[model samples]
Target: MAVAAAFTLPLVVPARAAAPAQAAEVAAKPGSPSPAFKTVGLRTQLNWMQAMPDTMPLAQMSIPGTHETMAFYGTAFAEAQEFKESPQKSLTMQLDAGIRALDIRVHPQGGVDGDRLHIWHGAADQKAELGSGVLGPLRDWLGKHPSETVLMNLSVEGTVDPSYCPGQDTASCMSGYFKEYVGPGKQYASLFWAPSVQGSSRAETPTLDKARGKVVLNVYRNSAGNPYSGWGLNYGTDAGYKAQVQDEYKVGTPSAITTKWNQVQAFLATTRTKRAGNLPYYNFLSGTGIPFLTPSDVAGGGSTGSGDPTDPPTYFTGVNERALGFLRTDSGERTGVMMMDYPGYGLIDEIIRHNPTSRAGTAVEQNGQLNAFVRASDGNLVRSYLPYDAQGTQGPWVQETVGATLKAPKMAGNPVATVRNDKTVDVFYRSDEGHLIEAWRPPGGTWQYADFSTSGYAPATIAGDPAVVNHNGVIRVFSRNPANNHLMESVLPTQGSTAGRWEKWDHADVTGAPQIFSSATAVVRQDKTVDVIYRTADNRVNHSYLAPGSSWKQELIPTEPPKGEGKLGEVAGDLSVVAQGSTISVFSRDAATNHLTESLLTGGVWVHTDVTAETNAPELSGSPVAALRSDNTLDVYYRSKDGHLIEAWLNSGSGTWQQFDFSNPVYHYAPPQIAGDPAIAIRPGKVSVFTQSGTGSHLTESWLTTSTWTNWDMTADNRAPVLG
Candidate 1:
């Protein structure tokens, strides 16, 4: 294992651009709202606890958590979380990414006789039963990540159960449920870091070493309407390990977030410098008092509890966003247990980074060989992969389902995929909401998401297809600023920042304003110079290049090239580019003639070929996708005029080009009726293509081997559920 040095955050913090406040309103308004930014998810601190010394007091460390964690299914005013999904799946995402505290409230159903516990948020039912939704997942997480411990504040959410106790023996009645599910001879009971029989030890706070793999219970109130002294750690008053609290949950309105933040910051300052024995500080950052400033608004600054961009921003910045800014500047501070709502936009990772013994970062990486991904009808992303040195089929194998991002209201276009030298796989696309979303997976891990457009990370409003080029480990994502039809770029923050957000620069503009272009494609050379080609609005092809540490250079391909000298060679649709060593290949459709044209870039010279005319290929109906083999042989596939998949191939050494039709019956293979365009992937001995089934919307796949073209495929229906 590599020893990681402590990470220092960048001096300049990235935030949404603040709108200039009107001079007249400065005195009248309580405060001008902070610049608004959308919620972009980052990698969680999965095992930071394992890096901490076991002897450290859990109370002396900073812990990130959610308040009313499962209260997401109710009226907008009652909902407390924005990661909308089933309780188990939502909770697990938080847990895997460094959340250690859970604030759960449950109402006992069927009176005092039944063990069924229903989750609620005041007047609304949250659609979850305790045993299955909350406890089961927690136990499972502790079992898998045994180096961690959980602090749960479980309280009765309703009045019916406690009222059923007849005002006497409420403690005795509650003891029965524990004995049934978590009592003597029950394996679970031993893992509960609670007194065997609560007495004078009601306020014991254990060290991480003593409570590893255990649930440290904290009871808010008792069934008998008395102090919860007999159950576990007393969070109220008058206990040896009593909690020092700062829960200003009723901040009046959304604009009062600054006031609430000042209070939280002042409290944390004291916890780090002062010594109050081993007493823990339970600083609750969750607040809501008005309908407009509900929990959703105060958390991530999104209105209506929806993370999508269609919902308007809450003028005032959210607590989660602000907290992230403050926490990044703090070092080795004991935040105690910092509870919040809508734990996103880098909120969880920022909180865990304050722990003294942590090696916290903003990314999660794993080791795996092959993977596939797609967008589901419900707007979720699914993944499937094969292990290294293993046999596997191209699939819609659906390992993990990444839900709609907080910034994207709707997913649009096909996902563009790439793998870096470090084996990090990423899928980029533009959302129908004019946002650019990146769905990336770490080695051996599931998909994680980030949206560049939401935080004003783009130079202009993003729309249309987005292009990505990876040079070494640095990735550059490009999108056209549809407002002015100018090409723009946002570079990944791979150094000097732990925020994991992409940053945009003014100098990256290719085809500046007033110079209109479409369907831009990018490719990187061995020398690290990037080349981008786009079709001019006038139907001519233009090429631009940018070398490292140099200014942008521009060129135009001759409209009447040598390959199709007597014919018009204007680009009509998509531009697909592939760079092999010293040569670059670009495929496009002729605007005047529906024929596919191949343009090659080599040694600063341009060579053109009309593949459709040369091979007698049928006219193309959809955009074409090109792939390169180890030997530098290239193959391009597109949907034909008659709806069949047509492939055009050419060998590097030979100038000859050939055509293959998957729809031909002579090969005797069953190929699904493919709709739209086709995608290609190649390994050492095999090459494959995937499409969407025109009839039932299933994902269709076809491939070829050494001696003959052979294929096996899977659709979205057959993917195994491997993620929450």
Candidate 2:
């Protein structure tokens, strides 16, 4: 599975749930706002949720006095019944507002001659029926719109009144009724697309195209009696249903509701990961038992203790509001089916947005233009070019498979590339055999390959990606020897020397093993010294360097000690280093907070600073990348917590930092989700950034020209692109 960032949203707990009388008082207040209705229009996308029409409010469908039995149970029971989970709108209304997942509790009652299935909520006062009430209308609507799908979870709930199921076994009767009314033989049978229950695991649910005008019937229980058992997906066990409030009548406090909501969120977090070949995940974001709050409570009811009826508690406004926060924070993890009460309150819009999609990894730029080198899905190295004309107008991006004849395995780490003095590009990646493979192209020439294992005394296995840099005229490639975890260096032959060959340095650093997921970053100082920074196994950022021709030396960048006495938590991701004049700044993500932290190597000491704190931005979602602009100012780019691209820059003159959101305005349709660390290149007034789109993992580029931003979809599924 592709590693991606998980979305999470936070929920705020209210003070308390209002008493029944207080709720009534709040609802009766004059000048109360009119009830809010479902308003999200029909969806243009092809998804079960997007295609269904709105549903009628649950409250409007229930027959008055239907809750008499529950009310007879006492005050607590009666109060719970008052908190109506159903909305006032119809199914079509909810569908219009974006409700795709339906929670139906069918009781064998309310059909013609009193022998039919009716939608039941365990309340006697509520009326139920299959055809005109719910199933029939749903079928009719689906017929009108064949491009949509619905997930209907039919379960036998409430009392099986003999008047409703007069004949055989109740479960079998209900199942037979469903088949007779909505099965393929029915008038709307063509609209029923029974997803195969066998081999359901690993089989992706049909896409919108395949599921259009289809009903994904989920027989929650009594599947043995379901005539359509083999036709639709069914789970023998009731594992998918999660109740937000186990005893709705007892949930009288807002904190209790908050706790339940958190439970649902936690359940989703874990279940999403384990959702392989299982029944679709479903979340019931509605509360039961507490009956004092009605559908009107959502928008009108006041707090219990507060006398001002107009100041109603938020819990009364709608359960959907409580769920919005979670959905907002949901990081596109697969949220199978989210069922809600009063869903039209804009909650469905948020849920629909959390659909997960693949995105491209890191990206790089070359020759002041954007160039991406990716290991294709087929294990081929591919390059994409986004060329800009002399007029500053960008051209269409072109992509080609590079080193196609090599038949290399998919690279384990992002490929790194550097430009030689002859303008040739040298790209380095670790081959499947753990050998460091270098693919280079001479000016307008075909690519050539060199294997380090065959060249010299290089280690047969390298643990991670290699970093390359051009020092004066020599091309130095740095990697980690997996055997001893020691840093290794191999130097490519100088520009035009036919006698020169790739050779490994005789010495290995004693800085311990570098993190397998991190690669060394090399920067050459004006004084001819080469400085390389990497994370050590001890969870410390170590700087290893060679002063001119001096022996290699390693030093740990000082970090703030932990509260009691333990080393700082492990570094979260890779380290980025950039040098301007004599100042070298190293950027890394703090494992504890995921915030961007910086260490300045000035003089001979390292000073630590919290870069994100100064900028007041959220914790970064990916590794950070930095580039030195023409003005000598430092510009850092990183993905924000929301999967949008953000840039923080230092004002060269004032030395103050400012941040900008690069993804919101232009890439809002699909934010630039950094699958890998982003790459940056600078030219005069231009700053080009390359990132992988989280939606499709495609190569995406955004550059700033005179403060204006322009973007391009460069290529698809390339490991973070590197600039050469």
Candidate 3:
């Protein structure tokens, strides 16, 4: 007759009614984090642990046409509903890997109670052995006592005969075979399993099984013990065993090794054929009349074979992949998607990996149409093709059209800049004829495009970074009008009778053309106020602000006073502004003395201070970038004259800039483009900076958190699409 089994066993009462209080406690504790579980004092533990050869680790047990192996080492818990419920209980062992051969034993509060349980070679075959190799007479007693939780475990064992190699020289990573039995020459064996359950598990093993398997778990190897050797043991519940050793592992003589090797040597002497990383081990846990069975699942496909559990360190740990563009935003659903997509389709799921942040907005691709396919800061595929003919309407994100023919622009190309509000987003780019065009999203619809192209306005060429912001429920767009040397601001209403239409244009009270005079930067503060920093034609940094609904308030902040009134040549100033409460702090790199100065707004009064001495008193020339941390601390990332990324932070609530060198700066990359326009964003504990790399257009992003600084060079210079 053919026999079958279930996934888990039935909970049975061995004697009296099982207590409910203990079960309730166990259920409650499951919700909270606990230490790793450990099993001890099982009468069977001492005997079964002793019965198994110390040198040979049971790793893989196989059936016909299939081989199942343990993926990692899980905690062995001694479970009981209550202390008085059943003293004669046994624990069951379940494996994440496939089950093949099982070694079972019974420990009667005193008498011998164990069974080999049932054995099978395939799905259809079963062999029940009750007398030899496992179960004794007490096996029947174990079956009658259902309340006893069995301490069941599987010991996967393998056979490693030197003949398998036959004098081969080349061995695979994590797997080494003896070419020929030499004198006292040493051989390496590998035992891999999970060290902890919470983190990703990795391991390495060898096999003649042809198919390479996934890295094994709980990597264990025997070595000549050294006192300084790093020996890590991870066990217990999730909150349980946590041990760390730094630079503890060092090479030493065989005699200096620990006793674990001696125990391994003794086991090897008697059980040379049964080495670690071989055959699988299975244990019998009490179950319904039908037991829960685990079949053989190999790491790699093919004949389930095993390898040396003792391998070198290089084969186990290293950088595997890179994470990028972690952004947060509101989603139509709860737990909105946190995207990490790049221009190269190198998108990875980062949803909820870290706690969500309220300050950042979700990133989405503008749309699959035109150049709109770029990924947003938030990480969603923003299809901006939605129809937003009416204001207050937003569109849905649709999938890209497969094999669809893409059309070029109707006339000339239009250069545009886009920004998103709470729910709506708008873009305004220069069209073919130098006229500005607008596209925006309404309340609940897609983006609608409009050409606000006008006739000849002026002969002046507009040149400067355009600024966009959502203030007081009104969307505003500003750009420099080089003709009249003025800052032009346009209002796009979010809740208007004609939602997608713009109200009218207003002129800001600040202006300067780079080619004609000095440099300037305009930024909108969090308080719905506008602040602009510029270098006057006299070579000094100056600051000005646009009040809620008033004119600009200009303040002069000088590094080195000009000898005369007007200065020659274009004086460039690298300026950045961030708002803290109602005040705005503007930092600028002065052109004359190559120093940094700051201007602050306190209770409507502007205070100018020379902050260069606090920033390491270093020479500066290029543009500086800044981002606000959760602590409300402003971290400034900048490029030195030598073209390396440097950092400075306002240590105290007061605006005192303290220079702090970045840990992992691009020290060796030649011709570093740190001087280029630097961009920064602060989210949670992480701050990311995007800058050009070594005079190349490829953007290299470096991230800094409390722990470490990581960098990833965007895409290679090759424009070809990455082939899968």
lDDT of each: 0.60, 0.52, 0.31
lDDT of 2: 0.52
Local accuracy of candidate 2 as per-residue lDDT tens digits, 295-361: 2233122344454676643423334454554443332234556554333333444454344211233
Best-matching candidate per TM-score:
2
TM-score of each: 0.46, 0.52, 0.38
Candidate 3 ranges with C-alpha deviation above 4 Å: 1-419, 427-461, 494-500, 503-520, 523-527, 535-546, 549-571, 653-655, 661-675, 717-724
Question: Model 3 misses residue 634 by how many Å?
Answer: 0.7
Model 2, which residues run further than 4 Å from truth?
1-370, 377-379, 386-396, 403-408, 431-435, 451-461, 481-484, 493-499, 505-517, 560-570, 666-675, 715-724
Backbone clash count for every predicted candidate, in the order shown = 5, 62, 86
Native-referenced Cα lDDT, model 3: 0.31
Q: Write the per-residue lDDT of candidate 3 for residues 1-724, one digit (tens) a residue.
A: 0000100111211111111110111211211111101111111111111111111122321110011111111111111111112222211121111111222211111112222222222222122222232222123333332111111122112222234335642122002211111112311011112221112222222221211111122222211111111111222222221111111212122122222223322332322223222322211111110111111000000111243455422111000011112111111011111110000111111111111111111112233111122212212222323233356454332333211122211211112233454544454544223344555565457556555435222122333333444455565555545455454556666674967566544244333322212223455555557665554434445565567768656556433223211112213333566665566656665433445555555555445444454446555535565545655666666655544556777665443567744423444222233324455544456565655443222334566678676765542523211110
Error of 1 at 266 (Å): 54
